[model samples]
Target: MEGKPEDDGGDLTRRGFLGGTGAALVVAGVPTLGGVGVEEEGVSTQLLEAVPQTAIRVTVNGTEHRVEVEDRWTLNEFLRDHIGLTGSKIGCNRGECGACTVLLDGEPVYSCSTLAVWADGREIVTVEGLERGGDVSPLQQAFMDHNAAQCGFCTPGQLMTATALLDRIPQPTTGEVREAMVGNLCRCSNYNAIVEAVLAAAATSGSGGAQ
Candidate 1:
């Protein structure tokens, strides 16, 4: 029988030999003909090539914020972590719950679902921005007056939605308020009071009846 392939001093098989050689080449910092490094860590290091962090400028509630964030960061992260504005609650982070609602360019958007990069150079409005000169907005007053909130988890989102509705329909009918706030779920089952609150706010603000 052909002499058993000369046993290497070590248990190194042909595949193992090639693997170790590749790893050594990689660690040696050798560049391959393919213009890539031979080592795994070398490849990873090359791929990571420290890029300068991107700087994002966003206007939140009329205040400008210059923040450095990764491309993957979400608007919710920017709002809660970067700016210290945490009034917008994070319920189901997947955008199913309206708890993280905020206004972007005058439209209600789910901050959790929106990427921070996408919000760059845009105006954002959060619950904390609703007050004027430290006075609560009429919608907020209406919520309290009508006992529209309980447990208070969904109130921020409710207020934001109500603000948007009133901006569009100053005097929303009871049915219109219900339809507009459909996305916001109140675990407290305070829909009746919430509707009343919105209608009251519309009348107070002189928005006229809902279309």
Candidate 2:
């Protein structure tokens, strides 16, 4: 037999090196965005499209919104970015910090860890929602009165958690207040003031209702 060409020993051309001749990537439930598609050599590729979207109806601060959100987005991102409610800060970007806490159906939850899709048909309350008739809620006023917010970064989360406690107990003891707010970490270490504010609000008006 004739000697084979040296090039026949798998000369690694870019095209030949590829494992597959035609490549396609398809993800279920993902929608294509506005972009152009190009085809070459019987292979088709699309521009980067958005991730999977979920249309949800959520009531925030007594206002209902029907919006489309990417499935991977967190609740904090949805509120601050999409809904224009930036009170919930993204501190630590994890559940531990509690800076992104918000009330979901009258319960405090870490928005940073929760998915926006989980809020479908549910009520959400942020620090912005604590106002009634152009006036801050009793709990908020108490916080200011007691100077509970030193840095104010964690105030929103603290206030949200306190609001839930007062709503349930309506007059939680100092120990109860401390226990309930344990999840919220205050960098300023103003625990006493925060507890005082919550107690004061409860004594005056336990209307920490999620409005």
Number of the top TM-score candidate? 2
What is candidate 1's lDDT per residue for 1-211, written digit by digit as tens?
Answer: 2122446636556644654565677566433323542346535445423323478899998889888776776899778765667788888889887888988987888888999988989999999888888778888998999999899998998888888888887777788888988888888888899899888888887542111
lDDT, candidate 1, at 90:
88
Per model, how many backbone clashes are there?
A: 3, 0
Tell me the lDDT of candidate 2: 0.84
Off by over 4 Å in 2: 1-32, 35-49
Clashing pairs in 2: none
Question: For model 2, how does the per-residue alpha-carbon lDDT over 1-211 read when each residue is reduced to its tens digit?
Answer: 2234437756555533332222222232223544345557868675765567899999998899999988998999899867778789888997898989999998899999989998999999999999878899899999999999998999999989998898889988899999999899988899999999999999888766555
**Best candidate (score: lDDT):** 2
The collision pairs in model 1 are 26-39, 170-207, 171-210
TM-score of 1: 0.73
Query: At residue 66, what lDDT does model 2 achieve?
Result: 98
